[model samples]
Target: MTCSTLWCALASLACLLAAHNAFAALSVDATPPYIKPCRKSDPELNQCIKHSFEHLRPYLIKGIPEIKLQSIEPLRIPKMVMDNGHGAVRVRAQFSNITVIGATNYTILDVKGNVTTYKIELALSIPRIETTGSYEVNGNVLLFPVRSRGDFWAFFSNITGSGKIYGKEVIKNGVRFMKTEKLLVDFKLTKSKFKIKDHLNGHNVIGEAMNQFLNQNSNEIIEEMKPGATAAIGKHFKNFLNGAFLQIPIPVWLKD
Candidate 1:
């Protein structure tokens, strides 16, 4: 073959190789398999979603505040009985004094199991700072169910309920005078009893009775509060209640 012809053939081969390299590079860059926020159509969208949540973790954590419970005490009954087929256990309890010290006097709360099925009543009194008369608040029976623990935690750490407050009234005593308000509030608890260990740990079992009372009372107080004031109060109330709930005993020691 002539030298010129051979040189031309070699040149064509070089050009073809260069073109092939460029196409391969472009294909790799344009169609990478990795998924990203900008690449929504990528096959790994699930991973991208997870990554997005991870990035947002700090903001989510900052948004939610913690709940605190003040004091829990026993009210009407000291002990209650429960039979879950595991064996019958007597649950002793006390009602808690819940105080949300700030502008908001509300809380996020949970009632586990069948809390809504049993009858509940509430009476509230607001002492006078300067006046002789005290405000009494009452409402009709309201159904507040104890929801599944897992579900309640997944939603807002707090929950809200609404009911009516009776009008205020006055009374007189022998040329003297007094005033009061009476409101009727009602609620129910389910007959079912949960396993002690399922909802609490350590000493919480023995304290279940008290925990129950605290949970019930705090919820009632939150329900009775003004709607406009709830959001601010709810977080503090939650913190107060959470602390009070943890004080319940997991097991009680019986004296021989």
Candidate 2:
């Protein structure tokens, strides 16, 4: 296949993972035999969907083979680059081999949907998050020129967030399907801690100082990078969701 054709194929395979709450809801009696779909006419549809997510959590934590979802525990992100700051925290950094823990612990605060318009809104809270990875960074932070390559660790507490899922329905082979068009998500951290082990032999002072500064002003730093961070997260989840929607028909997930 040509490059464009290959891309088209890949996208179709990932299509739309339906918001599954509002944007996505599979029939409890569908072939998948996994999802407990909510009814479009139910008055407590949102809460019922929330229960569906709860029921599906264990499978999602371990992955679902039929739908091709992978384990989310210690969720792996191969790489992330940040260079968007120009203020007191101007820096260019590449993070690699990242693993995060605590996604399975999310508490659904609210879920709202309008399948008619193919929109989904979700809210949740996470008590804590821990992450580790390798990083390379250079440029000015807190107005001081710094360069470092190291293994990094971070902790976040009391995170609260919400997101919106957007999609449009399309007809393929006379079957209705939803194609994810856009996603938006954001979150806030009540407390944060950061550490970077300076790979350069015994340059502990600079690393320690920087870590201290980062921990002390993590709120500011997080704000500086929030846009890129949230965008990357949304992109990752969108693709992951697509994996399920592509495999299952819309009628199987939610019927009119």
Q: What are the clash counts of all predictions, listed in order?
A: 50, 6
TM-score of 2: 0.80
lDDT: worst 10-residue window of model 2: 1-10
* Candidate 2 residue lDDT tens string, 1-256: 0000011111112222323232324432455545666678888878876776666666656766544456666566676665646567667777788777775777778888887887878777778778788888888867678888888888777877777778778765566776667877777768777888988637588788778888877788788767656665567667755545544557765755
User: Runs in model 1 with CA error above 4 Å?
Assistant: 1-92, 97-156, 171-181, 186-256
Error of 1 at 161 (Å): 2.2
Find the candidate with the highest TM-score and give its number.
2
RMSD each, Å: 32.7, 7.7
lDDT of 1: 0.21
Task: Write the residue-wise lDDT of candidate 1 on 199-222 in tens digits.
Answer: 333444533543364354544432
> How do all models score by TM-score?
0.18, 0.80
Best by lDDT: 2
Local distance difference test values of all predictions, in order: 0.21, 0.64
